[model samples]
Target: MNGEGKVVCVTGASGYIASWIVKLLLLRGYTVNATVRDPNDKKKTDHLLALEGAKERLKLFKANLLEEGSFEHAIDGCDAVFHTASPVTLTVVADPQAELIDPAVKGTINILKTCTKVSFVKRVIVTSSISTVMFPRSPLGPTDLVDETTFSDPSLCEEKKLWYVLSKTLAEDAAWRFANANEIDLIVMNPGLVIGPILQPTLNFSVDVIVNFINGKNFFNRRYHRFVDVRDVALAHIKALETPSANGRYIIEGPIVTTNDVEKVLREFFPDLCNDDKREDIDMITKTYKLSVEKVKSLGIEFTPTETSLRDTVLSLKEKCLI
Candidate 1:
């Protein structure tokens, strides 16, 4: 087994993407130290404990991203760390620093600080979002592809009150600064809007978007949506750890699509669930952008078909009785 006798820590283990990573890690025979806010909460963690290798290899630890040493116990002695714990909010709040920035920047720094303290910790993988790399900017040329080289302007995010984007950008920036200064092997995975199956019961931001569409509660405006399977994002984390040559950031994404594109997929595959009434006023636009996957594809990561991902997501929602 690739993960035989290896151990790793996955922060925010109960999240939409992290849960999948933990499961994949366990199946590969790695001892997993998973961090969540409340390890004792069954609603948040029961699904994790029910996984194939949970009994023998998985251990849940309560940790908070805001606290400085919260992650020390969880990350200590692990071979690598996946820092997926961070605040995510799209709406405006009274305090951006308290609610968004502190947990992200300080939390990321805390994880790296622990990694530096532990002699056995070799690599650190941070689950950053595509929002960090791309943002609402002036249109690029048709041939221009947004790649790893481009980063969302923090000032712009702050000015426009894109709290989520600001948090991610600052956190990833902090991670890089810490990693480089301390000479830690850091691989950052920037995934597009991740959707697929959910291991945890609660709905995540992205999954909620799918559910809203299914329920036909239309609040979405015309925007280019980039997507990637949660499963692929999970495997990519493991692959980044296993692949010795893997370094820097990798953008795991698919073709840029629109809400209309996704709606068409849903209405075609899930005819019964499509609510046409709410979508009547949706602005159908052809706006789209290009995201280069050359870096991630270099790691031999092939994306799941967008339609398959959407269909599987809806199926998972049905299986879980979320919709």
Candidate 2:
């Protein structure tokens, strides 16, 4: 469907990746109904309002992932819904199902259900993670390149230990099941570690990782990076929505680099932040893993190079005074 004049609802509109998606959608002349947990949070909404054409076309709605029908109002009369609201945290929670899995799965079901109720809704694009398709399973062959077809085996998820991975896997599976049973046009975009500069420095999660690294918080001094820029991932979502021929899953993979590679880039770009005298206590693991992007490429999208992505991320951090 053409997004020229269509109204689209983007959940987690204040987030790192979702905010970019909202900005791009507004720039493309699409009306955006951006959902946030709290509409009163001026700090977040103000940045979105400041985006080009956002004030004219963007609408903010308060919604919760666990609350039933919370998204219905935001999605009402909308042509498409971009479900990017899901819990992403490093700390393991007590109840993975409640904190992570339930929200991811239930929120998807809620959004799709709302779409089914609205006849004008033709597409539902979900923001899934590469973790759903990539790690957790031992590589079958020497080539670790995973694709849309690759799914993380739940058997590999030890109870609630690797709860984040399990949550994504279960949530995505639930989405597919609901889509197939309801016969809805469902497309999922699985992005790797998302890193980039943010429209608002306060809303930058990807930048936090870079900042932590610069501050020597990465305990092992280890480098094992697999990431994609938030901008590219946002563009992929827009493409998935506009490209009617696009269906099923797409793996959005960026160039694979290690922590050392990130450090090297920092040293070149922000020498002030790089301490050569500091001992490298971190371990660097350069394991080969490829995420097949042929499907997304077929939809006429190209990803930025790993070096460029890293530089952009570093530059963004520097701009925000994070590094």
Candidate 3:
């Protein structure tokens, strides 16, 4: 909000979280240079085009994660850069490292290299995940609490073959190292499972956790994790960019949630989709995880309540006719 009319570039502008970041920037009157893999792909870009300030303020560029120097054109002359592009998946694939780690780690290096080329760029805000801080659905003590200071041990992720977590952990580490070595201004926002309303017509990764549960597609193990509203994470990105004192990593986790909470919320809004008889199978909040949010709170953010987020997430899906 401090620098109106300033130019900003957001990579993966069509992604689950990046779309919200672009929306917030456009609404605030910033000239947004948004990068997608294909500028011609209507399916990937139509949601962004529908945003309030998209017509006059939004500019789309074709960029790729693996291609070198692809982001240089879009980032040139921008005041700030948001590196939000990364691979995400829950299903186990044939090659984990190649699909998840390679793009995330290499893509981060490429973006930072672009920053060095674009000398006028003031700061880089990276959208890192809480996986960089803690492992989800992994064993933890009852009193254990994860915060920004905690860095996940990649060995465990490797042993368990948790590709998504390993990818995020490696990517966040790579970004911080490159920024420090090159003396580039960098701030990282580590958010937990991002869930909320949809901007893109396609289903976002976080939204799937809820949709699958309501539809009873969850045949595998039920993951217990914390969640944050996507909109709040977007605000944290801008706040970190504008606030001078904001530095290093900030935990943007919301409420600690369980499968039981998911069932309860769905039953209240859509009884047709809910099967109350299966509630006995869901483990109550006997085991929960907590993250310290005092640092992000200090940045003057008022997080939306989890109940409100869950309600909006379902409503958004219904409006989109995706349910």
The lDDT of each candidate is 0.86, 0.80, 0.85
TM-score of each: 0.93, 0.90, 0.92
Q: Considering only N, C-alpha and C atoms within 3 Å, which residue pairs clash in candidate 3?
A: none
lDDT of 1: 0.86
Best by lDDT: 1
Cα error of candidate 2 at position 153, Å: 1.3
Candidate 3 C-alpha lDDT tens digits along 248-271: 999988765656676778878777
Greater lDDT among 1 and 2 belongs to: 1
**Residues 1-323, model 2: lDDT tens digits:** 24577899999998889989998998889999999998888977888988998878899999998888888889998988999999887564888778888888888888888888878888899999887886556654546656788898877865436788888888899999999999989999998778777776583555677767666555334446666878889999999987879999998877667666777776677576653324553322224555578898887778777677778887776786665
lDDT (Cα, 0-100) at 196 in candidate 2: 75
C-alpha RMSD for every candidate: 2.4, 2.8, 2.6
Runs in model 1 with CA error above 4 Å? 136-139, 268-288
For model 1, how does the per-residue alpha-carbon lDDT over 1-323 read when each residue is reduced to its tens digit?
A: 79989989999999999999999999999999999999889998999999999999999999998788988899888999998998777876899999999989999998999888889998999999988887646535556678888888888888888898999999999899888999999999999778999988878888887887777754455445667999999999999999999999999887767667788888865677654443343432223446689988888788899889999998898889887
Model 3 regions more than 4 Å off = 136-139, 217-220, 223-225, 275-289
Candidate of highest TM-score: 1
Q: Candidate 1: which pairs clash?
A: none
Candidate 2 residue runs with Cα over 4 Å from true position: 136-141, 219-221, 272-286
**lDDT, ranked from best to worst:** 1, 3, 2
